[model samples]
Target: MRYAYYPGCSLQASAKEYDLSLKAVCNRLDIELVELKDWNCCGATPAYTVDPLLAMGLSARNLALAEAEDLSVIVAPCPACYKNLRKAGKALEEDPELREKVNDMLTEHKLDSIPKVKLPLEVIASDFDWDALEVERPLAGLNVACYYGCPVARPKGGFDNREAPQAMHLLVEKLGGQPVPFAYDTKCCGGGIVFTRDEISLDLTAKLLTKAKAAGADCLSVMCPLCHLMLDAYQSQAVRRLDTRFDLPALYFTQLMGLALGLGREELGLERNMVAPFSLLERMGLKV
Candidate 1:
């Protein structure tokens, strides 16, 4: 169950909790994550916008590093990172000329082949045997709104369906938690332009929060770091902008999985969440 791991920029910083919970859950599952040496950023959202070639080169560098390790699969927790890496891998594999140009940019390393880019969600869904998993504290009463954001199921022909994905729902059911029907599950979080056009991002995030709350979701189960940032870190701004009272907590799916597996709060980095779930967990008779 070993795979080359890419934490990306967000996971190392603003989304550190995601990284922490992911490692904790993986450790429990006996999944070994061999992180790539000298791994760099995957260019995230802004790289391609500035220069398409540069974006490919940046992501390709990391792929080259992974290829050097001889690992066939590389898992990126951040959706943006996954999207960039996946795009770069596909481009480099399909277009030899483009790969050469990008290789020229990578003077120190050459990309003979690119590794398969997978999201952490994809890894958990495809690799693990759900029936064999031990759930010490089942999420019996919790209703989770599994938000995939945009990039996760996108660029098509991936693991889950582009329109109606069910991996998260199945995982929630497996953990004894109810997965609420969320129409905006694939909606854009406006994370790409969140910094430039904050108003648009806030409005979009507010809509998601309002919709999730209306659907009776106890909390949002998210997999993307940017989506989590928009939904959790900037939730207050969204609420204030909309003049609404949506105090929904946005949690990484790994965090919820850790809780179901009887992992401690601190172990999962639960305290780092902007909108704390302590009250919600306490209400559900779950330890905080």
Candidate 2:
């Protein structure tokens, strides 16, 4: 019913729509999202490859802070943050040396090992009563392709099935929507290369969206803000670069869930999207 929420850096800036929609949906669903105060970045992209320990340490600090709170789960919206924290948390829990180093770093800031870290989707889809979610709304008619895209389901330590994740599909079914299976569901969205080698990202995203479209997915669902950014924001560029016209709307899993729960477009932050959901809303018969 209640969980500690970490919006991470992307949600605060690039992914603010996700944060807003999540809060609005939680309010509508009577779920409480308690944001952890003074939570810093989950080390973002820079820390990961350069210094793995520093990345873990930074994530550990945030995790330690969240764990200190009286909550067992921290629902992170950003895949980067979720992956970083989840990997760091697993490392801290299983790898004694890594745990000791992280703990020492945490003590430097007067913190302790805190609650476990997880993506909000994972926690909500798994920990909560699935039957209750099914009763909320029927997402059976809507065709959705679930995109895991790197961090959220990787590292093989956290929750959900590693090879073929069905959690999102289960959630989609709970919301009365049909989940369309696709090949690139767990494939990289070309995230890290988005800024540096943008052409590659655009091409990959274009192909991914094309695959989703070809799979008969009316819309794409994702838990990662970065994935949303790549799929939604960069879509136009991808289309331009690849000389193709694919206008499939990308929806945050929370946004679609909120819509199905009888929430309006504004409530679900549909206005902040790069790829307009007007047609999709029309398909869903939702008035904007």
Candidate 3:
């Protein structure tokens, strides 16, 4: 199956590992991710908060590009991008007047409709055929806390469940990894203000770290790049701030999946993680 892919700004810069690993995994499964040409940012919450029309317009522009690609689904790697893109697409399809206004702002002109916006994980979990899928190495003894974070299953009923999400657990089982039932799985991670507001970000991340460790999670498996940044980059600081050492690493889910699918470490960008989980993978006899 093929889908229009949107890497977003974070995937190009901070979260390149996620993009690489996701592509590697999908390629192995014979899934084609045709990137939407000349796509722009989905205009995050702050942008929408400042100017609603501009944010929607920006998101609509990307949708139009994807539509031009003759794609019905757009798989976004970043949670923020997926959330905003879905929001814009849904809003436009529901409101004719607003859709017309947003279309006027687009350079591509008339966008009668928008495609479905979703995360890569959702596609894998819901649609992938388990019978044909191969696992080169089982993720045995790996206790993973599937961190859905905020934007994943938020803003009420869209795609995934808000409180109890089980898709990640099913995937962990498929990969031979134990999915730890971690508290605060859907919690927020202080987002883009980790530097500006260290205390809040640290505290929130600390809560997740502490909970994951307590739940016997070897590491936290995250889908969103921003959540990866907060939990991976600021985790050590959160431990220091909390006066406890939670040495659990934050890993992108695709990284683990790629490893299971027999992809090389370099192919998955495994070493690029802030809190590298290679040691744990190596110890578990997972060939890199």
Residues 125-168, model 3: lDDT tens digits:
77788777698899999999998887656765556777788777
- Would you list the C-alpha lDDT of every candidate in the order shown? 0.90, 0.79, 0.85
CA deviation > 4 Å runs, candidate 2: 49-53, 94-111, 134-140
Q: Rank the candidates by lDDT, best first.
A: 1, 3, 2
Model 3 is weakest, by summed lDDT over 10 consecutive residues, at 151-160
- TM per candidate comes to 0.96, 0.89, 0.96
Locate the minimum summed-lDDT window of 10 residues in model 1. 149-158
True-structure lDDT of candidate 2: 0.79
Clashes in each model (backbone N, CA, C under 3 Å)? 0, 9, 0
lDDT of 1 by residue, 1-288 (tens): 889999998888999999999999999999989898989988776778899899999999999888888888999988778888988899899999999899999976799967998888888999888877899989999999999888655677689888898888999899989999899999998887898999998999999999999899999999988899999999999988876676799999999999999999988999999999999998887775
Model 1, position 69: C-alpha lDDT score? 87
